[model samples]
Target: MFTPILAISASLNDSQRIHALKVGANDFINKPFIEAELAARIKNMLLTQQLYQQIAMQKEALEKMAMTDQLTGLYNRHFLMPYVEKALSSAQRYNYPLSIVMIDLDKFKLINDDLGHDAGDKLLCGIAHILENNCRSEDAAIRLGGDEFLVVLPHCSLEQAKFKTETLRQAITELPPASHKTSASFGLSSTEEGNFIFEQLFSMADSAAYQAKMNGGNDICH
Candidate 1:
């Protein structure tokens, strides 16, 4: 909400009116102003403020849409780089641990082929919900396109990350029968002091995830 400013003056002059506007006045009225005119000015100022607020809200909504995945209602790849950069900077400055977990649904295409794209979408949303429920409020769960997802855990050690991923893996395995026996492979990377670059860390996690898939999906590798 915005506060409307109405500048009232005894002796109105061009210089005084300009000064009032410069000082954040929405409208200026002389001492002997008519009550109807003052009321009209107040009404206009309120309407203008309402319009400004609406514009700000709309801009915020658009920005959120740009960074969110429409399918799963999770953060999309567009939000990943900036978030990683900021989290990494904070981790380095504070000398804390940060972890990244890469998740890929096992045999996802088979599900799509067998059940249909709608079923595939349902499973993805289900998995995203599980991820959201399992993570801390400060953590980020992201959909990195297709059947791939990533979790960012700030202030988490490598061992802790592995434990969490294992729990999540089990959760996916135990999903409702409607999910058609879903499973996933998890690859984890962590830095205790934020010494590694984002690319390096992400590559390590991705390779680990690939290895997990190779070892027979539904596994975790770090």
Candidate 2:
């Protein structure tokens, strides 16, 4: 819990100090903090702070396990939900549209069965890159594991979401497929009314994505 307080800014306001406290920071001092005084404050906070760097690091590690895919750096299913909800709320509050696009790598099993798992993993990572590159700052991308990926786009309409999905569809298609052909199916849903129903919102879009897969791969269905 011990953290050295070097006043991050000379002009820091009371609100900034309060912000530091909320993050478990201790000992607020005005900037131009003498090295000695800062050291003393750190020493004082060390015992009380419970040496939190360890705790902080462990907390982050646990969060990574919870929120991220173990094999890929992409986020997990549970982590995708909140961002989607928050985006929906923001859109509703401001009378904007929020959309989500779900992408699933098609014929993934054949790659593993024929080429083996290593190549499959590389393809997954590649998809992660393509999906991430396609998103804007307000969008979030997550890997729901086992070749499933989802994106939450804030302040976006169905048209915009479809465009983003199509971009990813193209990116994935251009990537050299593994020994067997690789492809993706996309489904998109947007909040037409203000309040977005959680489960069914995704269900419709997810179903659409499956339909795309059934028809053929590398296509997006809204």
Candidate 3:
């Protein structure tokens, strides 16, 4: 609801009042009405508008909380699948490539063990900031729980994804070093076909990420 609407007219017939009410009039005033009454109604309408704006802002904040990671302030796993599906559908419909990149911190457990959980969290948040800065407005950065992250690139090719992940890898290396040092591995997969399955793309990326880790981390595999 927005500002409360008012109907000011000389008509006082029952039908006229009913019509006003049905048309969403919150208050009605007749011609030659008392100035005090008009002023009071105006004040009430202004108050109602303020309340409506407050409620709208609260609702927006709640929705953002539901979709975002509390620690990194990035999109959480809950937002990934749905958002990817929508982006993928649009990409497929338009015959454009869509890519997914899987990222995992290398030797992350050592950070928590040697330093502290708080330090580990700080590192993650720092990396999240890099991702947010590197990605375009059309891209999404997701915290897929723990030290795992995902990046969805709409209308981006596999090669483009590789370049982006390489950039991110370089950025990660610039983060303050942990006692055991900090690094990450990346994997990418892309499709231009409308019939491609989301799970298949994700699995490909995951496997490639695993390969990168096995090959001694700090690199991208596709």
Candidate 4:
């Protein structure tokens, strides 16, 4: 929602905007408004409205395209980095704690092979739903393609992260989709890797993800 913007005429030989600002206007335009000036102001207002509208639309769109997994409607890796980077920076700056949990489907290959891709897709979507519902609104779950999902907890400890992951695991199992046939493994890391370049941060989290997959598929390894 764009804040209301105001514009006034400069008839008093002063940029009435200064006074108008005090009169409940967010941003103001000057006086002695010529037709062109009026046109420009109105144009600007309309343009601003349009610009703001475009910005709003873009924001909504970006939220969907950048964050959401197209198929599962879960947050995607593209959005994860920016969100995590910001969280990491803020956490470090404020002496707060931040952690990441990477999840991967266990026996995924067998499931895809036996159930077919459609079923596999359904499982992925179901998994995403379970993870999202199991998390706090502030917490985010993202898909890094395939059967992998990463959850970033900005102010959470390893214990909180573990509890959350367990919640998701239980949810996925307890409320399995129609076939009742998918399971996941998780790996968590909460060590403070300070001032990492973006790529390094991702690489670190990614390495943790790989570890989750390799060391016995269904438990959290931090």
Residue 109 Cα positional deviation in candidate 2, in Å, after optimal superposition: 0.8
- The regions of model 1 sitting more than 4 angstroms off are 176-179
Q: Per-residue lDDT for 62-130 in model 4, tens only?
A: 867867789998888778777878877888878877778777788887877877988789888888878
Of 2 and 3, the candidate ahead on lDDT is 3
Which one is best on lDDT? 1
Against the true structure, candidate 1 reaches a TM-score of 0.95
Ranking by lDDT: 1, 3, 2, 4
Per-model TM-score, in order, reads: 0.95, 0.76, 0.95, 0.69
| lDDT of each residue in 1-222, candidate 2, tens digit only | 344453456877888888887876656787788889877876776755565777888998998799888777778887877776777677777888888888888888988888889888989988988877777777788887788888888778888887777778877876655446678999888887544876777897899899988888777887
The alpha-carbon deviation from the true structure for residue 115 of candidate 3, after best TM-score superposition, in angstroms, is: 0.4
**lDDT by residue (tens digit), candidate 1, 23-139:** 889899999989999999999999999998999899999999999999999999999999999998998888899999999999999989998898889889989999999999889
Query: Ranking by TM-score, best first?
Result: 1, 3, 2, 4
Report clash pairs, candidate 1.
none
> Which stretches of model 2 miss by more than 4 angstroms?
1-50, 193-195
Cα misplacement distance, residue 129 of candidate 4 (Å): 1.0
Worst 10-residue lDDT window, candidate 4 = 193-202
Clashing pairs in 3: none
lDDT of each residue in 1-222, candidate 3, tens digit only:
686898999867889999999989988999989999999999998998999999999999998999999999999977888898898888877889999999999999988888889889999999999999999999999999999999999879888888888899998988875356678989889995444588999899999999999999998999
User: Global CA lDDT of candidate 1, please?
Assistant: 0.91
